[model samples]
Target chain A: MKLEGKRLIWQEYQKEIADDHYFYARSCIRQTFFPGAEAVFVKIMKDELGKDIHDEQHHTSCTGIGYHADVVPFDTTMTVIARQFALMTEAGYENYAASCVTSFGLYTEVLETWHHFPEKEAQVREFLYKATGREFNKPKNLAHASDIVYKFRHQIAAKAKYKLIDKNTGEPLKVVEHIGCHYSKMFPHKGIGGAEYPYVLSGMIEAWGGEVIDYPERRHCCGFGFRQYIVQANRGFSLSCSKKKFDSMEPYQPDMIITNCPGCPMFLDRWQYALSEMEGKTYGKNNNGIPVFTYEEVAGMIMGYDPWKIGLQLHQVSAEPLLDKIGIPYDPLSKFKGKNGEDLGIPETPNYLKFYAD
Target chain B: MQKHIVVIGAGPAGLESSANLSNLGFRVTLVEKEEVTGGHLNKWHALFPSLASGKHTIEAIVKGLNPGIKIQTATKVTGIEAVNDYFTVSGHNGWQEKADAVVLTTGFQLFDSHRKEEYGYGIYENVITSADLEKQFASGKEFVNRQGKKPERVGFVHCVGSRDEKVNNLHCSKVCCITAVKQAIEVKQMIPEADVFCFYMDLRMFGRHYEELYKQAQEKYNIQFIRGRLSESTEDKDGNIIVKVEDTLLGKPLRIKVGLLVLMAGMEFPPATKALTNMLGLKNVSDGFIQPLDEVLHSNLTEIPGVFIAGTCSGPKSVSDTMADARSAALAVAEYLK
Candidate 1:
């Protein structure tokens, strides 16, 4: 399928993305659920590309989950984001790179609010200064890490050891790219290709030699509806939401599902597993379940980084077939085994995100 | 000297305006880009609410065309410049005309449903446009499924390409909501077994007798209305379209699988209209339709003294409204020639 409205031109996709010296703010959900993926992102920025990405210890969370979960008030969340800006200014960086889609969306929301109501911005500044004698400078450009990776996809591809093509058939793998709702929904112009056909992940899929699949549910939210999934009684709403996406994409038989959001990847993978146990149906080839990955994980693999170190084994659905399909050599015994091939017995995980050593 | 007026399109507006202006004893030249000239009205299977044949309506309008009016077919207008006393219009194929006044009735092109990629118009097999549905109805295919079986459910999604910030179009396509209501009734009449649903952000029943049709759709046809914009559409393994929408009325997210999904694509500024606008230096409102000199007082007059706009090229309108507006534009031209 065609990429639709989004062409390969970088500027037409999104306004601007900074290349260096960025103040990186981690996502609460991204760090907790996919910790290794975040670490891999930092590794790629520092070791692989030698870019300066400051993930300072004192940089507070954007509290996007707390805000969306309705646990935190608007003032509290704005203050926390303001505090993060203070941390960035203290570190002398003007570019803000968010690790999570929710945080990126929140950042955009607050920025757009400030644009619409400069008085609200002044209030935020006063609130920040009054809360902690901290003076801050607004970031010049705000970008999601996924957006950065998308901007640099071709640069990384030129150094990649392999394309995202199925090795057996020698054809580009059919990849379905799911953009997080927050990345583009709130303010489309701030997003890649203005939300209609977001080019963020799709551009990377194209750049890395993968055939992008277009399904009707391509733009639907992962249904993480943070509050919906957080409350035990409302989990059905979230599950049914992803069920719609899975049911839609199943007909196309994509080789893998890739998302730019942490919660989306976590939910998409978990829900597919949940759907199988609940409905007695599976979507992946050979009944292994389709592999879902963050753009960071896939980018790392294509960069020829060690998959185990990047925590590919931590996924609920095994990425084993994907690794094998791409002909990336992974020792099955070492999957549960440690780096030194020692038995570090894994702790018991939940039934939904069931892990290795179970 | 004969009072001459040049009309830019030979669609209903041009035909009606040419006929009306010629009746007032003014010489008229009707220019059309296509080899034949019913414009968009020529393609429709039937009109809304009444299910009357659009062909018959267009044929009558063409029959009413004054024999004194000259018809220029398959001609492309490149520019129109207002000379000292009259307007000089130039076109390809060495065609030229001069008139005391000009009327732009370029009409409009239906919004490209493909632009809203989430709806899966071109990508999904089961999804078709409202215009396509009319043609399907015209062909006497009451129920259309690839398997030739009656569909279990049919969905009509309003505003596929209108009033959406995502596509850079913010004006409501005036007739779509009522059109959806009318089409839903037709679907129910065709397949009595099928459940019909209309998903819309808001239903605008502004036209006369339109609200009655909507009431009939609800009371008589038993068509369901969901008050929310359909977020996206996806297909199941069996080629059934699964639509996801937030039922704002009930404050719940809903998904339904339907065998046929109709996207009510809206109207857009046609290239022909834009070409005319640029060539004649006509000003367009923020929504991109040619702006009238005064939206209320001088709805037919353009900023360029004697240039007038008519029909859907001015904005979204129903056929009846367009015909009324075209006649008013004819009067404005007639008044200008005086």
Candidate 2:
């Protein structure tokens, strides 16, 4: 990306987007915390869009968390990636789309290394062949699944029950797009937009008729400094990073935040919850916290999917107010209580966003 | 006829070369795209350490220009082509000139702060690049936020677009460090109530008295120096910029909010240099700046005979360095013509 004194002409940035035959790689954190996001993504691809997407049983974790957390060695991490590639070869898909930003970055980094150092490539290839006799070729295109969604954003908007705008005010809902650091910072050339001014998430927000907030700290790391969060004492460093973003963006009065990374949405969501507990201060109006959604969950929301099925309720911060803002109707009782079970009416837990009365 | 020479750009280097070559009995045409000369020197309020006025310095250089030299204002050189020993330079308005020799003092532009979008320069009103801050100083205007109130704290962030492989700019901009230090002091001088901080990966005060100014920023001016690159900057409720950075020296992340944030934008090759090189068949080094015949001893000469390079157009340089380079280029042109 050639920048003339930091000006980004909206039409100049070009990125490659493959239309079909995607081999999806899921994130461990996403599966553990927000499992329904990938499920909803797969559902959209299969039922809604009629695209062939693989959510294979054999495709395991990318081991990026372990590698970043510093427990797994670099060689072991490369072998795991080789094994994942072998699975893709068997699946016969040539496009590699990663659900996690870290995984996408790792894939980009390892591929770049392979491009530069053939010996390292030979080593990983040999290890894969010896372990499972599974031979694989590199994918024709490597991309984050969010990039694919961004590419087809206009199509998704066309099929939508609603535009991401405030119904009453007739204003486009103010949305902040948080790009994961690993998504572009490590390998800018590989990402949808180059590292400095990535337009991947913002493009989707714009396409869906949402006002993408260009807040001061828009490109900040989500504070998923891997070891910073994994290590107990260093967690302050992790949380402080998010606070910095929050303090910068609070003035914008953002209705929602959308992220391309698995860990970032979780961090942004949970940190708001944690901040309220620790400081007794809330950001959103009337103490209703701003909703944080992964790009996949948002794609599902805009497509009018059931909120529960998309796993938004799993978030610590509430998405209830945002649902109300976008004019999406849901049974209030079902938000706090379970299905076909007793109306264990909201007496036990205090509803965070006050979707249920105290 | 006396040897006719063309000097592209109107910065210190271009002006110095024109004056020196004209004094050497060459009829020089100094081409400037702007109505005025001085380039970046006009933008700065003062230089570092000594705190000398930038305007007066440029005036002194302008005063030295030989009267015989012809000045062309608001004229851009579109292309340069070698025909035999003479080069034909053409640009907008059907403007064309033939030169026995051409000296490209095209000069460098500041690194784009928007490339480091994490700093929130264009997006946030309180967040601006060093060049923007210098404009505020040069104008002597009261520093104000987006809401037109005096800022309480101002931050100076170094290495906005330099020393980062993400933007494909790995070379140090060479002057931004000391420039930040100078600006921090100036900010403190004007707004004594406002706290100032410098966030940097490394303080490259590799010039004379630059380290002293760094020390003075801490000791005399009370400007805080943190040894870390800023991670990101965000704006608060009142348009205050909030920054997060790992205090690498402290081994922990530090978050601070300031009323104003200034990114120490680095230097990069000017776009005009790219066009000029294409027109003149010049090659740039790997770092994107124009390449000399050889970096060490033949820094003034380009691959084509009678074609010379000067100032930050070749690479990052200080005002004094640019002038010296321009003078050396003048000497080289005189020898080439002889």
Candidate 3:
């Protein structure tokens, strides 16, 4: 494969991300699955970078999941998105940065719909005013949180306590970046690297000193098709999708997988354990499953944040192997510790995959 | 005084037109941009349907050209201006000729396979275009993958850069369908044990004997013709290409791994032809090929009085069709000169 050709494509997919002052919209799935990702992102923006990012408690879900599952009406979803815009306007911020790829995709779709059909925008305005008595102005800029991270990757790398390099081998870690399909599939121009070869997560991986693996199934879905995963019987199809990715990437023997999408990391992480249980096959080396991480958690880890503090311990596959390879010191006993220094108790361990619970 | 004519592009069309015009006793000057006369014909290994040698074909066409006709190689026409009654054609190499009429047979360029990112043409080592495969065949080396292993399976993806709105080309590139079939058959002949598959949206066997070649591919060569468009291709660890395409007939998705994947890139108007059109203020059809005075009646004549277009520059055409169009254009020029 020609790296120069892919570099040319990556150059074309660069999108405009605002430098500062963002109205942050959190993901419902990210907060539920990997709770620390959004928290670390907010902390990195405000405490680390000293950027003004308002995370409003009043803002609610964009109903992306319900809308994609065909349960929520389009009009209702548009109004909900309009309400989020109302909160952004109310907070006096114009740059809307979404933590979830699905919300970002929904926002892009709604904005495009309004751009094409002004009448729909006017109708949504009436619906929002009638439902919540709120006024809104569309955000001047819409960027995914990973876009912001990608924008600040170099700066974050400069302040890093460790690089995504194996200290033992002195080589850049082979990292596979799985982008959320919704991040760019619906609208290629909206994402950092467009649809075919998205660079949102890979940009972060490259800046943090890792080799990005362009695996065969790199563009495949993470098996979290909103409708497919929501339905009980169709769950197997979702598992198969993730399994396909695992089967394809296994040959490369990547050190870890990093993802920008909320469900992608969760599915790519959890499904490794599930696939091991069902098929007795593991993708990682020496009976260890490949570690999956959100971009935020990866950034936070490289930037010297405590692994336990950033909720890396909550992962199904243990991150200890990667930490040891990178020579990052961690306290294994504090894996289940809470914010107030209390033990949250350990979870059950899988038979095939390695898990740390003490 | 004998009337002089300038023929641009020394491909099949230009060669045929120059020969016909020269035989009719006109002073013909053939301008070729390449060091050699034949355009894409020089690069081709074999012709379709008959699988005749492209070298022999070009030799036959070149043999027809009279010694009286001046053949200027390595001459690229930079500008053509119509004077009061005649025209002056100037080339980049400082060669210029005054002629009573000008014939444009600039031909067509192969679609750049790199434009289709999903196919992984440039990024993948084993994924190549139809033109690239022809070069390999012409090289006389054993058909092998980048690793020099005999490819166990080969795939031919049809209609790339043609009839696809994503790339902004909607017209059917009239020759790629048969080219894929022909190349697939060649691949089978090269590796008799290799599994050859052709993924196509439609099998347009519109030409004579083209349907027979397609049928022979199915019955004799055992080539699998899957009715589908390839969605994307990815490279395996061994440098093989894994293609994902849906079998539209079976209503199912298929993932096939091939040692080599050949993308049947279609034809498009070369930039030189477009520049000529712009220079002459010639009308172009919606598909961007130079428009003729009339499709059926005056296809050889453009709106300009002394300017005529033939071959794929007017539109995508097979070698036979281009040769016929060149002859028709020669007749039109002869009639106008009379």
Candidate 4:
């Protein structure tokens, strides 16, 4: 049997795996914005991996963003975290996966703090026990979705049926990956596969025959400068963060930019259009900007799964040219293959990328 | 000819003033020294009182802006002179603008935490500024030290830069007390096992929500708020930080060891402001805030005609106050220009 992308990732990075059961703790960002990534992950776990994944709707948002903003009190955030952990423990799962990097970072921080501060932990635990009527400790594994994907890289690679051969060059493509802050900077030590330069996303990109480009602002924050977004009321802050990446990437000109976290992807993708408006410059003649893909979407695409099935069509930034560069033109006018190989036509172009060249 | 209004500082105050003036049918030009426009708020993850994320505040004001206002970022105002009734401002880029009115919204800069050597901010890896914590929080990380270890105990040193007679900064920074309280509570919330302590000279719960927030940190979060200033901090080889200070509340000198130490550095005007004040002939108060003829009556109006001041450039202020000042300055400039 040929090596699949997910399998390749696993072979390179998997430390331990109890794959039968997974506790899927959904992210607030995922539910609010990147629902497609959630749907795709669920589908992958259920259909392909044949794993029993638990996603409790009762689990409220991590509220990390709000808590960090200093808007929501610490006690309120603790209640939410405790309730979510209780829900997971009640479901008979010790392992949990976060869709957003921020959630993972917060969960880990809260848990470590709770474990270290026994008196406070007891108070919180007792309070949660009274409120939810459930005994709970911190989760054993607060894994990001990329963690599992990277763990099972080989399996994912072997599953690829459709190869993304470049039409112009007749070779595998070149790519760049932007790891979100929630994943890398927040906890640099426990990152996926613990590679100094974790090859999780880049490894998969290479498996699909694309080279990962390291740009200047690779480690720079997206300057979503969330506070700046509101208090100062200037669009320039956002533009500057996006421009750093754009200007850096302009010289290298990678075919596409891949990211793991939803927030990073949203800013990078949406800001491209905003940048165009600010600079009065178009990226390409057809104005097709850099396409963004999540680690799962990229892995699934390499696995030869239909684009729509893996939520590729839902991206605000078009991945159409990316598909073309890989020797497969994702015909927007034409239908895409569904799970059962049924036809689902290409999605409507987002307003950000409404104008596209032929 | 369109009456051009030039606004100094691209921070919240500057942006707000420009936007407000532009809305009233004035051609407004806003300048910022940095490449970005949000000011210090951009670096902060959350603010006290409502603990609102900086995003919501930034977006709300930004969304309410007049798009017609021309925003010039990465440009500094080098010289400003009143030519008759109009003000001419020059920039390093050789860019010059003649404004019918000016609003000096130049916000406060963070006091160099390192300058207070007793705090050990830059010297110790574990010793970080409140600004550093804000960035971590904004980046979505929980309150863990640079060592990747969850701190068992954390100490917050208040009034590190503010209210220091030695630094010639005698005025009480209105926000530091509440800010220290808020951070202590957050640390406790993140790590219930972690003991959190705030060493401060006085707990200034002056604002509307300020008192409530301080109480919540004490009553609800169980954070220990000590009314004492930190004397000095030292890091052991273990990297665990030890703080020596008089617990003024207890009136006894005590040593507390903690895994992390955060400095609540106060706000100040940058040195560049002195040059701007001299060149423009704008009167500055003893404490360096731009002085209006009557602060209460003409808070935004400067001594010179056609020039106004807003935000911390005038005096130390909270975010909410600075924003209000920004708008008031805008109205004053707009009314004058009209």
Model 2 backbone overlap count:
1
Question: Per-residue CA lDDT of candidate 4, range B1-338, in tens?
Answer: 88899888877888788778888888989888899788888887788877888777777777777888878888888988888878889888988998888788887878888666546666567889888888877777766887889999998888877899867888777888888887787778789888889887778888888888888888888788777777667555466777778877678978788899999888887778888988888777777777886877988887788878889988889998988888888788767766
Off by over 4 Å in 4: A1-358
Chain A TM-score, structure 1: 0.93
Docking quality class, candidate 2: acceptable
Using TM-score as the measure, the top candidate is 3
Q: Scored by Cα lDDT, where does model 2 land?
A: 0.83
Worst 10-residue stretch by lDDT in candidate 3 chain A? A349-358
Q: Looking at model 1 chain A, which ten-residue stretch has the lowest summed lDDT?
A: A1-10
Can you give the lDDT of residue B164 in candidate 3? 91
Which regions of candidate 3 fall more than 4 Å away from where they truly are?
A129-133, B92-96
Alpha-carbon deviation at B47 in model 3, angstroms: 0.8
Question: Which DockQ-derived CAPRI band holds candidate 3?
Answer: medium
Cα miss at B300, model 4 (Å)?
1.0
**Candidate number that wins on TM-score, 2 or 3:** 3
Error of 4 at B236 (Å): 1.3
Residue-level lDDT tens digits of model 4 in A1-358: 1124224333444444445578887777655454467777777777777778887778888887887667888777887888888888889898888887778777777776777887767787878878878777577777788777766666666666655457677765657777766664554545653322445577667666677665434555665645644446665777687776677666666777777776777777777767666565544336778777777777667665666556565565667777766645354543345556676655545454444322
